[model samples]
Target: MAPGVNDAIRQLILNGRLNATSVMMPAAYIGADEVDALEMLNAGTTRAAIGLHVTLTAPFKPMSNGFAPLRGGAFPPINDMMRLAMTRRLDIELLTIEIATQLQAFLSAFGHMPDFVDGHQHVHLLPQVRNAFLRVVSEIAPNAWVRQCGRVRAGRALHDPKSLVLDVLSLGFKSQAARHGLTTNPAFAGAYAFTPKARFSRIFPRFLRGLPDGGLIMCHPGFVDSALQSLDPVTTLREHEFAFFNSDAFLHVLAESGVTLAQPSGEARGAA
Candidate 1:
């Protein structure tokens, strides 16, 4: 969800290669150039879907303070957060406040609510976080669709454990969002193990084949810089993805797969 994390990603949007990106608020604030780049991207005609990337875990701080779990600018590991969820120890109120704070940050930077919202590591789908996320969006940004991770389809390799785990969490998420009067992308893909030297060219076409009509496939494509390399482990792969998507090869793959990239229909997007 950290779309403005680096220039390469922003340039992809500017060049009409990527259709959607998510903002990681603190990252944008800390590196204001990223925000500036986002402004440039938004000014263009690509109509890219810009969304918020909710961060509620380690390596990043919560937008709002005074929450016991994040008191010292320290984010617990994912396992700890999951444990807290299982024990009903998460402070839903604090979670709600932090999410709202991030939403406000997006509004301040972009002059409107996000085109959509999702968690940095899919945390929006986690137990307490999911509840807080749904409630806050329903209040402040009811029109924004939340990402609903659906099952990985047959085209993906069977050994794709990361995608499978995401699928399990995604089960019934659409119903949950619908109950909150929010909409979700019917399916999701573009998750992987991030193995070294893994080729996007090989896998991307498979994902295209697997996607259903109106499905959303998440991506993290950019040119690797020192900043991105430091913040994300999956660095070079971003360049690979950027290359493929920006190339005629990508268009060929889409043609071969009998699929095309398009914005979600207006009805699914709601008011904004």
Candidate 2:
């Protein structure tokens, strides 16, 4: 959520290399410049889809009050939040209120509903949290689709622990969305070890191996700055991803993989 990252995404949008991005409504670094850039791009003929990136973890403060579990006005870490969600210990009322607040913030800033909705760190797929998230989206932005991080096919990255965990958590998520009268992506990819030595160029093609049409592939392509380094451990890889996506190699890979970037469409209430 740093300015550098925003710049990278803006460039990607301008170059037609990126089709969609979710904005973190509560990020402190988001200012008028970033909003103006997004507004210009969104209002222009660019096909970029902007959505809300619901955040409920550390390094960001909560938007709603009465979160008894918060620590020092900040949301808990991802692991702790996961435990509470899985065990159904989270206060659903407070979580729902916070999500709605974030959605309102997005609407106030953009003057329109998000094109889609997803969570920061995939929190929208978790247990108690999912119930609250889907309900809020259905109520506040029924036209927006939600992200479902479940894989549709086995591939080289199938064994990756992070992918497996997301798969498990995403089981029945689409059905849940449907019950809420929402739509979700058919499949998902783009999980990898964010290690310093990891080469995004080499790992990205694996995400395309079996991705279905309208599938969603998440990526974090950004530039590193003091703010980014202070808030996240995934610094260098962002630059690596940005380089790959901004390079001819990315075009070659997409051509070789027989892939095309298209905006996902649906008429159902709350489709992604």
Candidate 3:
């Protein structure tokens, strides 16, 4: 998640300072670098889990060897896709092709299915995208894991999400996960915008407290590189994410909250 310095992010996670990461797929990727990184991380048998940051937006380069037909030589911009999703005119066929292609590319590089799957803009929860993504994943890798967008209330510091259209769409996707016997977090953390001045230890506890036990905690940690900054304006945010998640404060939160980062024995994950 670094500003093009993918290695920095991987190093921290491997050193046991961070426990989770997501990958940008078929976008600005130097084909197979992700696989190399994933394999290297998994070799340590670290608790760190890697999921696809399924890319459909972000003005960046698709892996030179990617599987999508870029419209006008760039991604169908994120906003455009949102408009299409809203207008019911998105290119579902290409969406399916892109997801399937990214998954295959990831497997080719890692030699296994991804640890989990999500999306760059929560697009996987959209209708045509969800149906298409589920179909591709279930068809190609039925045993693979997928992330579900689960939100539950502990208190009201975080505003409750109130988009009925989004919820209805996500519910259908959640049901699809159940139908396929996939696992998801019992609750999700509110993704705050990144702040450069933040300390990892200080910021993580509140997020930890907000989470219900056993669901996945998503964090983006990366190196800040000029290339990455050019592509991802929020590179500094993830640097803070890396610093915070790796901080002693986060571990203290885990201990105090009795939150287990990974389930023992690979059993079903749920709220405590």
After superposition, the stretches of candidate 2 with alpha carbons farther than 4 Å from their true spots are 156-158, 264-272
TM-score result, candidate 2:
0.95
- What lDDT tens digits, residue by residue, belong to model 2 across residues 12-72? 8888888888899889876667778887875637458888999999888888877658877
What candidate 1 gets wrong by more than 4 Å, as runs, is 1-5, 28-33, 44-46, 155-158, 264-272
lDDT (C-alpha) at residue 111 in model 1? 77
lDDT of each: 0.74, 0.84, 0.63
Report the lDDT tens digits of candidate 1 across residue range 136-244.
Answer: 9989998888898775466456687777767877775667889999988877877876888688888776676557776777788777666665566777787788888
Backbone clash total for model 2 is 3
lDDT of 3 by residue, 61-101 (tens): 45444435466666777667667777777667777777888
**The 10-residue segment with the lowest total lDDT in model 1:** 263-272
TM-score of 3: 0.81
**TM-score head-to-head 1 vs 2, winner:** 2
TM-score of each: 0.89, 0.95, 0.81
* Model 3 residue 197 distance off true place after TM-score fit, in angstroms: 7.7
